[model samples]
Every structure is written in C-alpha cells, then in structure tokens.
Target chain A: MELIVPILAAAVRSGTPILYATLGEIMTEKSGVLNLGLEGIMLIGAYVGFIVTYNTGSPFWGLVAAFFVGMAVNVVHAFLCISLKANQVICGLAMTMFGTGVSSLLGRGYVGETIAGLQAVALPGLSSFPVVGPVFFSQDVMVYISYLLVFVVWFLMYKTKFGLMIRAVGDSPLSAEAAGISVSAVRYASTLLGGGLVSLGGAYLTVVYSHMWVDLMTAGRGWIAVALVIFAIWNPLRAALGSYLFGGVEALQMRIQAGGTTVPAPLLMMLPYILTIAVLVVISVFKGRGRMLGAPSALGLPFYREERE
Target chain B: MRIKVEKRFYITKWQEVCIILASIVLAFSSGALVFHFLGVDPLEAYKMMIDGSLGDFYGVSETVAKTIPLIMCSLAVALSFTMVVWNIGAEGQFVLGALACTAFVRYLYVDNFVVMLACMGISALLAGGLWGAFAGFLKARWNVNEIITTLMMNYVAILLLQYFVYGSWRDPTSLGFPMTPLFPKSARLHQFFSTRVHSGIFFAVIIALILWIVVRKGVWGYEIRVSGQNPKAADYAGIRSTRNVILVMFLSGAIAGLAGMAEMAGLHRRLQPGFAVGYGYTAIIIAWLARLHPLAIIFVSFLFGALFVGGENLQIAMRLPLSSVQILQGLILFFLLGGEFFRNYRVSFISRKR
Candidate 1:
C-alpha cells in the first residue's frame, strides 16, 4: 500500500511518451503504412524540442517545432514509400539511421544543457482524494493532454467517417479506391498526422520527463511502442493500457535498483526487451492458430492503383 | 501535366549504371548541403575525408583492420539476405560470439597458439549460430516476424554481455573499470608485416571465397534462392522452407560471430563494453549495397572501412562529429533505395485531364 501510489504515479509519468508513439503508430498502421522510423523521429524530436525550448524558454513552442520537424522528416519516408514505391521496411531503417545521425550532429552543442520542465498541476478537490487523485490528477498539463488525446484518437479511429476511410484503405486499397476513396491522399494525411504525434511524444520526453537532452535518450521506447501497437491488437484504448503496463514495469525496475536488489542491473534492464520478444512470439502463435490478429491487411504494401491485376 | 509510373520489363545494364551514379551524386549533394549548414566547406571536407582514409600508410592499415570485421559481417548479412531470412540479429550474435570467445580463452588456458585460436573460433561460431537459430526457430514454428525478434534480441545480448563484464569477468588489476584481462600472447591474433592489420583479413578472404562458391554454385544455394523468390513454388518442388530458414540463419550468424572473434583476438585482445560499435548494423547497409553478392560485399566493406576511418579523421581534424559518417551512410542508402524505383519503373509525363 505504501509503495503502490508512487509506482502508479511513476507509471503514468513514464508511459506518456510511449502512449503518444503507440497511438500515432496505430493511426499510421490503420492507413496501411508501417513507419519503423519512430525511434529516429523521436530522437530528432527530442533534439529539436530541447533546442527550441532551451532557446525560447517556452515548452509550447518547443512542442510545435518538434511536431513540424517530425512531419518534415516523415515526408521523406512518405515520398520514398508512397511516391517512389521504395520498400517500406528498408526506407524506415534508413530514416532511423538518418535521423540518428542528423540529431547527434545537430545536438552536439546542446549536450548537458538543462531547462525548466513541465510542472505537475494538482486539481483542487481531486488532490484531496486517495491514490486515484495523486496518480491521475496531479500530473503535468501534457499528461492531461495525453489523456484527452487518447479519447480524441479513440473517437477519430472509431467514431468518425475519416476513421472508417482509413480502415477501408488499410483493409483493401483496391476496394477502397473502387468505393471512391482516394487511397494515396488518405495515406499521406495519416502518415503526416502520425508523424506529428510521434514527434510530440519525443517532445514529451525532453520537455516533460527528462527536462534535458541526450543523444538517443528515447532509447528503445519507440521500438517498444511499435511492439505495443501489435500487443494492443490495434485498439487505441488497449494501446493506453499496454503503454501504462510497460511504464509500470520500467518504474518498478528503477525502484528495485534503487532499493538495491541482488539481481544484476543489466539483467533488470533486459526485462522490457525480453518481455517484448515473449509477447511478440505469443501474439504470432495466436495469429498462426488463425486468431484475429489485428494487423492492417495491407500494412507494409505500397499501393499502386494501375499495376494491380 | 501529370506523371505516370509504368513498370519496366527489364533494366538495361547501362541504365543500371546510370542510376547507381545518379544515386551516388544525389547522396553527395545532400551531404554537401548538410556540410554547408555546419559551416564547413563541402568540397574541402570531401577531399580531406578521401585523403585521410587513403593518403598515408597508417591510414591504409587502419582501414584494412576495420575492413576485416566489416567484410566478415557483411558476408554474414548477405548470406541470410539471399534467403530472405531477415536475420537482423547479427549484432546480438556478434556480441554472443565475443562472449563465447572470452569465456573460452579465460577458462580453457590452452597453450598452443593455433589450437587455442581454432577453439575460440569454433566457440564463437556455435554460440552465434545457436543465438541466431533461436530466432529462426521462432519464425519457423510460430510464423513470428524475425525483424522485431532479432532487434529485441540485440538489447538482450548486449545486457547479458555487460552483466558478465561488469561482474565476474572484471579484471582485478584494472581497478573499477569494467573489462576483462588481456589474453595471453599466444591467444592473440598475429599481425601482418608489422602493422595492426591481422590474420583476420586472410580469414575473411577465405570465408568470402567459400561463401561465394556456396551461394553461386551449390545445390543448397539454389534451394535457398528458389524458396526466397517463390515460396509456394519451392514448397511444391519439395523444398523445406523452415529447415532452410533455420540453416541459413545459423550460417549467417556463425559468420557474423567470426567478426566478434576477430575484433577480440585481433583488435582489442580483451572483452569490453564498446568492443563492437555498430559494426553489425553497418554490415546491413553493406549487404544491401552489394546486392548480396559475396565479392561485391568485400568491395563495399572496404569502402565503408574508409568511411569509418575518415569519419574519425573528421572528428579530430575538422571538429565535426563522428555522426556525419552515419548521416552520409543514411543518405547513400536512402538514395539507393529510391533509385531502385527507377530501375523497376519508368516515369512519363502526360497532360492533365480537364
């Protein structure tokens, strides 16, 4: 009971960035595009966001800058995969490498710099409550925005016409085109929107969580978010649940280390990745057994209208 | 006017050469733009990079030393890529191989130089092969995506290596630093002609020759190619894809493992955290650029070796970050992939419909 509150609060705090990335990826995958460049985009965003916030002393402008930069970088991916009909997987890997290089080069001067991070806001009446208030209501404004964004994404994915069109294109681009939907246009829009959100996730890491910039600081969270999309089975609400669960594990690992557990630090660090592999294998097994794996049907395939037989 | 992209039946060799040249040119131009942003003279930077990597004997030897591991890893990636196995776990396999070699050298205490080296090499091969084959088994049995599995395994492998180095394997003499004791002189690889370039180059050459023959002419190679290009047809022809996937991945991993062994025995002579810095990932680009041909991989590895050396030079000489090389590598790959589109399809402009 004593340890529970802090762990829960930490979980929500740690999970925000992952939630952003996962939701953004869900949006992209729903449009039949798989952007494995999330790690790179997040890195670039972290750098750009930190730089902007460091210079302007405003986190909001930093986030806006990150969003635009992410979209701009993703435009290259969109062009390669959609217009040039390059292999999606290869293009994504290239984007990641490119982003890493670009960010590291640009971020050299800003290393070790610090900024005023987003402060937690305690709701007046809600703060007086037990675990729920402290964990949910006493978070930064960005965290609340994340909560609101979750519902917005859920609404956009399930309760809107545009959402239906995104799914239609993902299910079958040919059929969607026949149904009068512009497949390429929809893909471009979703990819860009997803890019912006992913960038925001990176910004959240720099401006809200770390409050300092480091090269490759997002670590493998972007990859975890990618894996989380599959684990969530492509549902927005499940993505939230999955992100929080991962966040909880991360927080618990830190606490265990701080508490000086006998387990090796390296082994403790390996937990999330090992869990990711285990979950991936289990999901694949279910999929192999003819379960309804919620992957977009045309996920990584480039849509070429005239070439289809 | 509107553009129409139509698939081409075949790309002529001349056109292929032109596309390759264009990709190289475009990549350089973009790199130049980046240099200009950094306030460096693009042409001077390029000249310095080229001269630094090739002008001096010391530079040439360093490049060769770098090329030894790169060629082996590139060959490893090329083998699996040929079979479409997607064994992106080379990084993990390489680390495991190094761990295996360190364990052998530390425990066995073999006296004969030749025998000790052979044992270390065998241990690396087996460890890496098993690590890679684990992912292959998952893919074969459960239809799992190898990309994510392999990638996740990299972190696990690195962490496991760190655990050993930081804990039980820490050299008592090194006072708090996380590293293993240096190997005995007999256990270390022999350098050639008074340079840091080791016998690993000979090993790379021999392995490349063997892989080239196996991939280009062997019956198993034919099966791998058939299965990768058309799985249904291969299945109808009675080829076991699952077995092929596992076998190819194991071999691929074993080869990459040799790179780890080379790095330890030839370069570092001890296990440390930064022993293999992204060599495995760099090999992926080399494999793709070489089109999975063993000979081409050798040539591409040398070019990448030069880039690595030059990247270091840039850091020391021009005050540019080492990541500039990574940026160049990324641009080259991006342009190459984009250029592949033109190789397959020809774009034509048509008047827009009113």
Candidate 2:
C-alpha cells in the first residue's frame, strides 16, 4: 500500500512524454500521413530543448525552439510525401536519419550540459484529493498542458470543420477534393502540427523529466508512441490510458531496480519493447487489421490527384 | 506562373538513368554544403574522402571488408522488400545470428575447421531465420503490424546481446572485458593474401547471385511479385499468401543471419560489444537505391561501403563526426525518392490563366 502512490506518480511522470507523442501521432495519422521518424524528431527536440534551456535558462523557449525545428525538419517529409508523391515509408525513414544525424552533429558540443528545468505545480483545487492529487495534479506544468492537449486534440479531431477535413482527406482525398477542400493544405498543416507536438513530447523528456540531454535518449519511446496509436484505436481518450499503462510498466521496472532485485538491467530494459510487441499482438488480434480499428484508410500511401480514375 | 504535373506512361531508359545520376549529384552537392557550413573546404573534404577510402590498397581492402557485410545485409533486406513485407528487424536478426554462432563456438568447439565453420553457419542461419519467422508468423496469423514488431525486436535483440556479453559471457582473462575469448585458430575465416578481406565476400557474392536468380526467374518469384502487388488477387488465385510470408521472412532472416555469422567468424572472431553497427539499416538505403535489384544492390553496397570507410577517414583527418555517413544516406534517399517521382511524372511550367 505504501508503494502505491510513488509508483502511480512515477507512472504519470514517465508516461507524459509518450502521451504527448501519441497524441501528436494521432493527429498526423488522422490526416493520413505516417511519420515513422518520431525517434529522430524526438531526439532533435530533446537536443534542442536541452541546448536552448541550457543557454537561455528557460525551458519555455527551449520547447518552442524544438517545436519549430522539428516542423522545419518535417516539411521535407510533407513535400516529398504529398507534393512529389514519393514513398511515404521510405521518406519517413530518411527523415529519421536526417533528424538523428543533424541533431547529433549540432549537439556534439553540448554534451553533459544541464539546465534548471520546469518545476511541479500542484493544481489549486485538486491537490487535497486522496490518491489522485499526488499522482496527477502535482507535476511539471508540461504535464498539465498535456492534459489540456488531450481534450483540445479530441475536440479538434471530432468537433471542428478542419477536423472534418482532416478525416475526409485521410479516408478519401478525392472525395475531399470534390467537396472543395484542399487536400494538400490540410495534410501539410496536419503534418506540421503533428511534427511540432511530437517535438514537444521530446522536449518534455529533457526539460521536465530528465533535466538534461543525452543522445537518442528518447530510446524507443517514439516507436512506443507509434504503437500506442494502434492500441488507442485512433482515439485521444484511449491514448491516455494506454500511455499510463506503459508508463506504469516502465515505472515498475525502475522501482524494482531501486528495490535492488537480482534481475539484470538489460533484462528489465527489454520489458517495455517486449510488452509493446505483446500488447500489439493483442490489439491486432482483437482489431483484425486497420479498417475495423479505424486506421486511416490511406495510411502509408501517397495521394496523386492527377491520375486517379 | 504555375507548374502542371502529368503522369507519363513511359520514360526512356536513358532518361531514367539520367534521373538516377542527377539524384546522386544533388545528394553529393548538398553534402558538400553541409561540409562548407562546418567550415571545411568542400572540395578538399570530398577529395580526402575519395583518397582515404579508395586511393590506396589498404583503404580499398578495408572497403572490401565492409562491402561484404553490406552486400549480405542488402540482399537480406532486398529479398523481403521485394515481396513488400518490411523486415526492419534485420539488425536484430543479424545480432541474434551472431549470438547463436557464438554459443556454438563457446560450448561446442571442435578441432576441425570445416566442422566449426559449418556449425557456426548452420546455427546462425537457423537462429536468425527463426527469429525473423517469429515476426512473420505474427504478421501472417493475426495481421500484426510487422514494422512495429520488427522495430521493437531490434531493441530487444541488442539488449539480449548486452545481457550475454556483460553478464555470463564476459571474458575472465582479458581484464574483465565484455567479450568471449577469441576462438581457436580453426574457427577463423580464411583471409586473402595479406589483406583484411576474408571469405565472407564469397558468401555475399554467391548469395547475391542466388537471390537474383530466385527473385527474377523462378516461379515462386512470380508468386512473390503477385502477392506483393495484389494480395487479394493472389488469394483469389489460391496462392497461400500466409505461407509465402513466413517462408520469405525465414529466408530473408536466414541470409541476414548468415551475414551476422560471417561478420563474427570472419572479422571479429568473438562476440563483443559494438557487434551490431547498423548494417541492417544501411542495407535498407542500399536496397532502395538499387530499386531492389540484386546486381544493382551489390554495386550500391560497394559505394556505401566506401562511404562508410570515407566517413571513418573524415573523423580521423578532418575532425568530422561519423554521423556524416548517416546524413549522406538520408540525403541520397531523399533525392532518390524525388527523382523517382520526376521519372514517372513530367512537370512543365505554364503561365497562370487569367
């Protein structure tokens, strides 16, 4: 019983970064573009976030810089996948490599740097609550923003005209075009927005959680976020649950180690990835491929408006 | 003014060649810009890269050594990609294969050279193939996304290797290093005349040729093509797509595993840290650059192997980071994808209509 609060709080803390990435990916995938380069994008964000915060002593600017740089990197993906109609999967991989390479090159001089990062703020009315107070309300400001973002994204994806256009373009570009919507514009915006949010997710890892930078420090969390998109069935609400569950697993791994068990570090590190595959298998079995699971119909496919029959 | 993009039914073979050449040129020029930004003279850096990787016999020999694994991995990736099944787990499969071969050498070493080599080769192929077939099995059975499964397995595979190397497999005699003891003399692959080159080149070349034939001329090759382009149609025609997926994944992983085994037995001679150096990911770029053609894959892999060596040279000579190789790869792929689009679609500028 005593271990419960710390574990739950750590779960929320650990999962917030992935939650941000998952939400961003939902928007990206909802608009029918698969950005598999989240790892590279997140790394770029982590690097930039740490660098900017280290130099300027403000994580807010650090996050803003990371977001912009990430979008700038993703624009190439947008141009290639949308305008040139190149292979989406391959182009996404290229983006990953580029972001990884560029960030590493630029970040070489900034290794071992640290910054005073964001501090936790207990929510005004919610801090006195029983178990939920310490678990959810007392976190860095970014976590609160993420909580707001879930609903904002949910509302944006389901409530607005732009959201309708994104869904239409993702499912059937020709139909959206016939309805007087610009498929290219919507896709470019969605991708740019998605890419920015993904970077923010990366920033959260550095500026909120770790307070420092490391090379490829997001590990496979970006990939985990991508998988969580499948588990969430493309819904914002479910993404939170899935992210926390993953976070709980990771937190447990850390806590078990802190408790000084005999298990090897590498074996424990393998748990999240193994669990990713396991949960993926379960979700895939129940979902039975994409269409039933509400996957974007044109996911990973290029849209060519000129030649369609 | 506006540009109108139109689909062209056919492009001349010469034009296709030109597009490919242009993409390579653009990638190099852009890479030069990066060098310039880094305060290095672009031309001098390029020259040094060329000279360091291909100028001397020693450089060329190392290039050849690197090309061997690239060729094997390229073929492994190209084979599965030919059928549109993404085997992103080649890196993992490669590591898994090396680990398996190490187990053979560690526990079941024999005095005979051929027997040791055969045991290593067989174990690697089976281990890697089964690991790959595991993903293929999930994909074929429940329709799990192979990309995520394969990608996740990569992390798991690397961690698994770390467990072995850092834990039980640590050499006791070598100052507590995280490596198994060096194999007996019989276990080493035969090298060429005083060069770093080993018999792994033969394995790479033979596999490339065999895969080229198997993919191009065989009946199963036709089925593979059909299944990739249109699975529903293949299913209607009574092609067991699931069986094909598993079989192809097995072969794909088997070849990659062989690459891993050869890398250890021929080059390193012991399983150690830094064993998986991303030849698997580089092989993806190689396969794509070659358009999945086995012969072309060899040619491209050779060039990438040179780049790999050249990047190493840059770090030593020009004080450039080795990540330059990854950047170059990304640039080349971007240009290639864009070039392919231009190849199939002709864009012409026209004044905006009033």
Candidate 3:
C-alpha cells in the first residue's frame, strides 16, 4: 500500500508537467509551427514563476509572470520565424537558448531556496470517492487545469471553425490566404498562446511541485514533450494519455530505485527515453503511416508571402 | 511614407570576415551585459575569463585542451551538414567512440603507443560510423525522419554509457562514483606541448584542412553539395543522392567518434557519465553559423572555444549562471539566422489593404 500510494502520487506529479508541455506543443503544431524552444522556454518560465511566487507569496502572481515571460519570448520567435518567414527550426532553437540563458542568469540567486507552493484543492463531491479520490479529485489546481486544457484544446482543434482555419493555415498558406484568412496572424497567435501554456507548465513545476528554482530543472522534459507530440500523433488528448503513461513509467522507475533494487540510477533514469523510442517504433509499425494525425502539411517550411505560388 | 531601397553589390571576402568579427563582438558584449547585471564589472569579468582560459601558460594549455574535441565535433557536424543529413547525434557518437576506445584500452594487454593509437582511433571510427549508418539506412530504406531517429539514438548511447559506468565498469576504489578504471599510459594521447595541449589539436586541424579540400575541389564533394542544395535536382543530374547522404553521415559520425577518443585519451583518461559537456550539441550551432563551410569552421570553432573558456570565467568571477553563456550562444545563432533573411529575401511594405 505504501509503495502503491507513492507511485500513484509520483505518476500524477510527473504527468502534470508533461501534460502541460505536450498540450501546448500540440496547439502550436496544429497551427503549423514546430516550436522546438519549449525546453528553453519552460526553464525560463519555471524560474520566473518561482521567483514571483516566492516574492509575492501568491501562486497566481507566479503564473501570471510565467505567462508574460513566455508570451514575450514567443513574440520574438513569431516575429522572426513567422512574420519574417525565417527558418522555423533555427528560430525555435534560438528561443530555447534565449529562454534558458535568461532564466539561468536571473535565477542564480534563487538556487537552494524554497518558496510558498500551491495548495492541493480537493474537489468537493469527487474527493469523497474511495480509491480514485486522491488520484483524481484531490490535486493542485494546475493538475486539474492541465486535464481541462486537454479537452479544451481537443474541442477547439477538432470541432470548431477556428480550429479548421488553424489546420488549414498549417496545411497550405496559399490555400488559406486565398480563402480570405490571415495565415501569419493565426500562426503568431497560436505560437504565442502555445508558448504561454508551455511556460505555465514550467512554472507549475517550480511553484507547485518543487517550490524551488534550480538550473535546467525541467531536465529534458521539454524534449520528451516534443517527442510526445509525434508519439501522440499531434492530438492533445492522446498527448495527455502518453504523458500519463510516460509519467507512470518514470514514477515506477523511481519507486524501484527507492526500493533498493540493484539497477543503477542512470539506467533507471534512461527508461523514459528508451521507452519513447520503442513506442515510436511500435506506433510506426502498427499504424502503417500516421499521416492522419493532423501533422501540419507544410510543417517546418518557411512561408514567403511574396513568393509566387 | 515609402522607404528608400538600397541596392548592394556582391558579397566580398572582407565583408565575410567583418560579419564574423561583428558577430563575435556582439555575442561577447551580450555575455558581458549579463555579467554587468549580476553586480560584476563586465570588463573585469571578461578579463578574468581570459585569464582563466589563456592568461598564463597553464590557461592556454587548458584552452587548447578543450578546443580539440570541439573542433572535431564541429567538423563532424559541418561535414555531414554539407550533405544536408542533419545528424544531431554527435554527442551519442562521441560517447560511443569513447566507449569503444576505452574498451580496447581496458581489455588489451600488449600495446605500443603507435599501435594503441591506431586501434583506439579505428575502434572509435567504426563504432560511430556503424551507428551513423544505422540512422542513414533507416532514412534510405524506410523513409524515417533522420532528425528523430538520430536524436533517439543519442538517448540510447547515453544510457549505454551510464549502464556500463554504473554497472560493469564501476571504478573499484572510487566509493561508488560512476566511472571506469584509468587507461594504460600507452593508450593516452601524447601531449604536443608541456602545457597539456594534446596532439588531438593537430589531428583535428589536419582533418579540417582535408575536409576543406574535399568539399572544395573533389568530385565526391561536388556530388554531396549538389544533393544537399537540391535533392531533386541532384537526382535529375544523375547523382545517387541516397548513397551520398549515407556516406556523409558515416563520415560525420566517425569524426565525432574520434572526438570522443580525444576526450578520453587526452583529458579525462577514463569514461564517466557527464564526459561530454555538450560539445556535440554545441557543434550543431557552430556548423550552421559557419555556413557549413569546412575552412570557415576553423575560425568559428576557435571563437566558440573562447566562449566556453570565457563563460566558465564569467561563472566563477561574476557568479553569472551557466545558462547565461548558453543564452549568448543562442543570441549568436539567432542573429546569424535572422541575418540570413537579408541574405535570401528582401522585405517591402505594400500599401495597406483597402
């Protein structure tokens, strides 16, 4: 029972951060931009949010600060890559570096410190349930928010006209532009919004999970989130499922390590990455070409508005 | 108001040098600004960095010591990039190469210096090339995305290293630290100078020059360039793009693997978990910023090496975070990439939509 509870708790905690990142990535990718800078942006967000929350003693302010910083970084990215039609990969990489560097430079003072963390908000009626109570009902607001965002994004992407336009823009700017839609604007908005959400996820890690600021604290979760985007076939809901599974695997590894299993920590830590590749290989084999997963038709191709189509 | 358009002449060689110099200055200044913000004098911090990296004989030796692996890694990425293979798995290749060379050093009993060097180098090359070829074969055969596959392989390589260090190769006397036993003296790379600068620098330079000649004057280089620039056109021109891509990836991975050997033999003398301080990943940025030009990589790589030394100094002297140095790197990449827009496209404002 003790082992089970800790594992369950670990899974929930681990999954939330990945859930935030994967969902955010799904949104940006839906609009035809592959923001590889999520890792860097998340680091920055985690730092900024932690600093703010520690200073103000309010989680809300911390979240706001993270959102603002994330949005600001996204603005730079959108301007250079989307508006200017520069290389998407390079721009994204730059964003990541910028976010990481800025965060580290500013966050130096906050190292080895703790802050006022978010309180777990138990759902009134749902919290009364037997086994599922702690698993689903009793959790911090960010955990519930991540779950809610998955559905919200799913509905927005699949069932709505706006979602269709976003998809269309990603598919072909020429067609979308001819249909009287602004491709650049939609891309910019989605990129920024996506960036903001990913940063919020980072902030949640610091403010809710660790209540501390540290260097490279996200520890490649950003890359895992990037891989999850592909693994889940760019679907926000599926991405959530993947995150949960990945979180469970990660949690299980930690539990076994804690249990004094002879396996090395590095090998245990590598489980998630190895599993990620395995899952990718299996999905590719079973699905026989995952083209229908809403992969942007013109993903990573820089759009030149003035070029003859 | 209509902005006047300026017509510019062809790009000059001098202009290229100027642009590089400007980039270095801008990147370093931005680095300094971070130090300034952290309550340290930027000038003094930079001085401290210089002092740490190359102010004295020992510092220069250490700087040269660090530069060899960097140059090799940069060359690895730069060479493959010419074929547009985008092999971002150099870090893994490096680790694999080190592992292979170390394995030879550990198990082998009789070894002359020359034979030992040849075996270690060959072992590294073979290991890295095989891994690189695996990624290439997947791309050619199944149409797998090389980026994702190569990246995934990196994790596999890292895990393999970690497993060995922590499991089979755990140093007996180190009190549970994840590292291997030290190599025999014969397996170690000979230092060129007393200051700790190893012969790896000479090897890297020679390799860079050879790559420059191959990319510039060789027929195979021509094929690689044609394919990288435009695959469809290369195919239409009767070039086997697939073979070239595979060949280049193999060569790239092999060179990166050699860098791993250099790190093990010249510096560390043993393998550990954090053996590579991200030299492979940083090489990607270096390759691109150098425009994937083999000759250009020499200057670009030295600049990066300086930044590494300088960044370390900034950390110690100014208490600036390590991430700030990475941020400067990102800014350089950003400006270079952003600069490419002007290189490739012209921006014009049309009348507002009525």
B204 in model 1: Cα distance from truth in Å?
1.8
Write candidate 1's Cα lDDT for A1-309 as tens digits: 678999999999999999999999999999999998898899988888898999999998999999999898899988888778787877887887888888888888888999986789988898779899998889999889889989999899889999999998988999999999999999998998999889889989999898999988988888888888888899989899988988998999999999999999999999888888898888888777343467788999898888675
Q: Which candidate should be chosen as best, given lDDT against the real structure?
A: 2
Top candidate on DockQ is 2
So what's the TM-score on candidate 2? 0.98
Assess the local accuracy of residue A231 in candidate 1 as a C-alpha lDDT between 0 and 100. Answer: 84
Comparison by DockQ, 1 against 3, better one: 1
What ranking of all candidate models by DockQ puts the best one first?
Answer: 2, 1, 3
Candidate 1's C-alpha runs over 4 A off are A289-292, B350-354
lDDT preference between candidates 1 and 2, better one: 2
Scored by TM against the true chain B, the candidates give: 0.95, 0.96, 0.90
Residue lDDT tens for model 1, B84-127: 88877889899998999999999997889999899999999999
CAPRI classification of candidate 3:
medium
Question: How does chain A of every candidate compare to the true chain A by TM-score?
Answer: 0.96, 0.97, 0.95
Instruction: Report each candidate's C-alpha RMSD, comma-separated, in the order given.
Output: 1.9, 1.5, 3.1
Using TM-score as the measure, what is the rank order of every candidate, best first? 2, 1, 3
Poorest stretch of ten by lDDT in candidate 1 chain B:
B274-283
Considering every candidate listed, which one attains the maximal TM-score? 2
